[model samples]
Target chain A: MASTDINSTVETVFRIEQARLIAGLTRMLRDVGLAEELAQDALVTALSEWPASGVPDNPGAWLLAVAKRRAIDRLRRAKMQERKHAEIGRDLDEDRGDDVERRDAALDDDIGDDLLNLIFIACHPVLSPEARAALTLRLIAGLTISEIARAFLSTEPTIAQRITRAKKVLQESGVAYEAPRGEARVLRLASVLEVIYLIFNEGYAATAGDDLVRADLCGEARRLGRILIGVAPDEPEAFGLLALMEIQASRLKARVGADGEAIPLPEQNRAQWDRLLIRRGLEALARAEALGGADGAYALQAAIAACHAHTGRAEDTDWAHIARLYDRLGQIVPSPVIELNRAVAHSMAFGPEAGLALLAPLETEATLRGYLPLYAAKGDFLFRAGRYAEARAAFDKAAGLSRNTAERNFLLKRAAACGPARPVMR
Target chain B: MRVMVMVKATKDSEQGVMPSTELLEAMGKYNEELVKAGIMLSGDGLKPSSQGKRIAFDGPKRSVIDGPFAETRELVAGYWIWEVRDMAEAVEWAKRCPNPMPGPSELEIRPFYEMADFGEAATPEIAERFDRLREDAKKR
Candidate 1:
């Protein structure tokens, strides 16, 4: 690589591995903010040294090594006498300037498994869902505040403040920098799973912007799920989450056209399905089931994914089973979204009226008041039932609520199909 | 052990928005449960930050600063002091407290010190006496 190319590549690698580096540093420093600052200091050292030293074989290890050395120097500078009591790990007997090798080894080994623990700590429910999601993307995914802000259609300062408050909340709660066990584990685990799911959904269906898929988000979310799988192999919900993501992600290649337009699932080319990912997803589902079927929310969702994976054609799907699974899911966790989904399955299984009956009750719900999918689903059922006027109104409402160019276009097309709501400025 | 359950305050809570009238009745019942179980020592709400002051001392100088501190994040609007056997028991009580900030709030359970906390040979610098003095003065 050319010199400048190599320099930029170093920057990119550091950014990619930023979370692992911070996780390592946070363990050593015990302060998330300070750990990040120290990690940045290491990045600064790299920008100045890599060109001169020609980039180390393992750049991540090199950054970790540099940060560790800096940490010891920092501790010494902060008043050695105070840290002396805490320095049972340190050979304070040796000259303070000497024994750099000892400090590096001590610092490096203690933080090897810390990154995953940091993810759990960051995702603790002590913070709001927004805060937990933002913090996870920052600490585990290694995303910049601006990068995160851009992904969510939010301002940079707002994202920054959200992250700041999240860290502060965890600290004030004394939530600890370690993973929980027993019932406490279950409480915090739900929040952690939700954050990862949100990250994946953002990738699977970009909330805003012209593009139908933001593949970068998919890669980040997948990486996070993979990490969770490794960290909590026996936790069935974790496996279920990873499995669901894998199966869903398996369809990504065919979800968009060459022109970057959205491709509805039925119309997409199945030949483009990633067989390897599908296999992995199937295996994860098996693992989740093997672990047990009274599975947590994520595992139940995985079972739903498996039904889709096993089908050869969209029309051949066992909608009856899907409806049953949705019913089971509703009983397990009552949510308006789940009810909406169950209604769709009911339509597919029985008839449009079956679905409409389920959906009509949700029409007056405060939670579903502004949700686009509620209108979209209602419109679909009405159109299939041959109520063109009702379908047109529902579709128009969906189109108004939706901001995604592709989604809005799709809904408008459905509205136009009812014949008479010819395309206008709306 | 006397565990002090610190209910982190919010702007709405401090405005005498004492839960809803319905929630107040639910809370009265919950407090009854606490009393029946013999855990509730004391519990009540505080006035808004508009009626509060933050005092800072540097050497002999004292700056008494005055509240709706509008700093929603820092306000500790109310608390319930409970004498619990251990941390686990304290958590159980906190779980039962009527959701203090139905809109946006949290309850923090912290352990309080007893008189025997300052036993023989305790260093003056790190003494419980100084800590107790700071705690008493702050509440005043």
Candidate 2:
């Protein structure tokens, strides 16, 4: 192979194996930062040797073996240094020997558990959300500092420091290199899922950035979700989360216009939706439901997305079914946003009056005070009800509250559609 | 993006020779890795071409041909649909796959055409027509 080809090949192999190697090493060494360093050391070794010998048959195992040997060497050197400084070095020798024996045993243990433990540690709730995302992408996804920075639209140095501080915090906190069990396991898994969804949302709809959709972030989140489901196969919520991401990702291409303007769901061209992803998502949703997680938070949302996906056109949507889902979803996790959605669903399923009745109570909601979607829904309902003056006022209010340039323009267009009011005929 | 990875047929495969136990085991492990990485959407190995039939159309004329077809190398023994970040990632994963057959073998990766690829041609009317066709086919 040419030099450049060999370099890229080695890099690809490294990317594939780095996560497992680091996870296994972290379990053995109980230090994530050091484990990552040893994984890199193994990659360097491969780069130097693989070109001469050709790629190994079992490259992943070869990388793991190399990383393990380096880890053992590092431990021995550290032990030797401690022995030199200590007056009572006799006991230390036996301790070192016992440690080596234990490390040897750990080598034969399941790598899946190690990977799961690494995920939990990286996504531990003690870390800040930003830190969790940065660390998880760096460790689990095998993404470099710069790659993560580019994904999140942050400065490279900022991301680097965030990751460094995150590692230091994990070490200082002395988080166990083991997956939690029982109730603790449930909470920790929730934290992991939350981080994954947060990453997906940041990509699906950038809250603060100019780019509305960052496909890379969504892809990473989906990858992470799949990994989570793989390791925790019995967890239905994992399947639910994966299903939700897949279905939502299916619409990514249809969600924007040529100028990158936001295209609301109703207006989006359904042809652009990714059918394969939708199929995968529906299958996953079925799995989640079969696992008796139909009532689960993520599963409920996935069901809603599936409703949209199952329909060929927006007007053909089974809004009554969606409204019932929102009713159930609202019961489980009450939110003003859910109420707003329920209103829109009711509007579609019944008439504009039904939606207006639902939206009336939400007007005093502190959280929904300036929420753009609320007014947008109200204006839509009012316009359909032939209350042009009220619809114009509501749309104007919605347009004023809009953040995205595309969304503001769309709302302004709606407001303008409601022309001057004429006197009512007696 | 998604790609269909086809394991090209060789002489042994065309003759209905089953994979050795070791090869099967290696492929199993490779598939598990793909699933865990959230790449493999669907995959299956096909029986030898002898059991398959093809139809040819020339204007209004229709002709039927039975397999085993000629040009064994062009025939597919198996295929997988994988969702990957890009073609490079797909290629990397494909490179990691075990040799699909005994002796020299080949794998081909072809990306599926995405809806965006159709540009303005993929109108709602066309999409709905395709949807109806799909539903009709499924019903049949």
Candidate 3:
């Protein structure tokens, strides 16, 4: 094989194996940062050797073996520093004699636990949100620094520093390499779910970019959520999150048109909607509810999504049920976003005037002032009520606030459709 | 039983930039829809052509060519391997695929060759080899 082929092949192999290698090594080393370093060392060795000898049949095992060897070497190098080093050093030395089998057994025994624990550790509350995202992507997703930066629209050096500092914080705090139990476990689990969902949300909405969506981020988040469900089968929120994302993700195809214009839910081709994702989402929702998480934030949102999923068209959507679910969601989380959504649902279930009544008061809300969706929702309600002049103004405001080109175009179109401003009858 | 849906590459996809979350979610939902309908076998998006490679064969002389291939319109960005009843069914399913790209995208669906289609061309030896190959594939 040529050098370029070998390089990319090695890269693909490393991408696939790095997470598992690090997960297993973390069990042996008890330090995520050190294990990652050792894994990198193995990758380096593969780049140098695989070209000469060709790729191995079991490349993952080969990389793990090399990483383990590096771990043993490091333990010997740091022998005099701590009793912890001495104990791990002795363990590594014994394991090396029966290397492949023992290593495989160790991997089989705690692979799931180790991966789940690593996720919690990466998302430990001690770190900042940015750091948690970078660390989680690096460890679990096996994304390169540049890849993470590109995905998040940040620079590589910035992401690199965030990851480096995050690892330092984990080591300095002496965080355990196992999932915490009791209330602490619940809190950590929430943080883990938050980080993954945040990643998915960013990809879905793209807060600042010109584009309306980022499929890669959503894909990564869904993949991570699925992994979490596999590793923590009993966690209802894990199921809830997967269900929520699945239902939301299912609509990605019909969200925009050929001209890159935003297609509102009512305008989207319901026939184009992914029924498989809807089914999986509904199944997940059932699982979450069966596990007694029906009132959970993600589960509630999933229930809301299910309302849309069950409909054959926008008109068939159970808006009243959705409004009730949003009410429950508001009681639990109490955000303006939820209120706005509830208002929209009320408008659909009740009347445009009712929705407008709720939205009118929110105009004075500090949080709603700069929120684009608020104005957009208001515009929709007004348009439905035949308050064209007001609707046009609301849509104009929405267009001004939006960063996405497609969304701005759609909003502007809505504003234009409202037609010439009418003179006041008074 | 199977068809391949090839999503032609666009300038944006060729550049390695990411798609927005909205599109991803929509496609994810669409994929779920396909799966729920029992029409989808498997699907995936591909990295840009710069990360790809091709091999040209001239009678036993094979040559490797790294990608960033010039024909953006002709290049494939991603594909879906689907299981459907027939070519018409495959085309119907293709019609339901999301735009895939923000501006404009195209999906070309082609039926896979079935052993039954070969008929008299399928000698006993060839059939046995095909059976062995399918069995081997299942092991993986």
CAPRI-style grade of the A/B interface in model 3: incorrect
lDDT of 1 by residue, A146-180 (tens): 87887776789999999988877776777677546
Q: Native-contact fraction for each model?
A: 0.00, 0.37, 0.00
What TM-score would chain A of each candidate receive against the reference chain A? Answer: 0.81, 0.88, 0.88
DockQ of 3: 0.02
Off by over 4 Å in 3: A52-54, A90-112, A206-214, A403-406, A416-419, A422-426, B1-140
Q: What DockQ number belongs to candidate 1?
A: 0.01
State residue A375's C-alpha deviation in candidate 3, in Å. Answer: 1.9
Pairs with backbone N, CA or C atoms under 3 Å apart (clashes), candidate 1 = B49-B67, B50-B67, B50-B68
Cα lDDT of model 2 by residue, A1-426, tens digit: 898888888887788778888887776677899989999999999999999998898888899778877866777777745644342233222222365565464454422466788999999998998999989998998888887777788889999999999999999998877667768888988999999999998887653334422556888899899888888787899999999999999988777655556667776777778888899899999999999999998999999999999998676789999999999999998999999998999999999999999999999999998998999999999999999888988998899998778889888899889997544333
TM-score for each model: 0.63, 0.86, 0.70
Residue B93 CA displacement from its true place in model 1, Å: 52
The runs of at least 3 residues in candidate 2 whose Cα sits more than 4 Å from the true structure, single-residue gaps closed, are A80-112, A206-213, A421-426, B55-64, B86-88, B113-140
Off by over 4 Å in 1: A12-17, A56-62, A80-112, A207-214, A257-261, A386-426, B1-140
lDDT of each: 0.73, 0.84, 0.80
* Top lDDT model: 2
Model 3 chain A poorest 10 in a row by lDDT:
A206-215
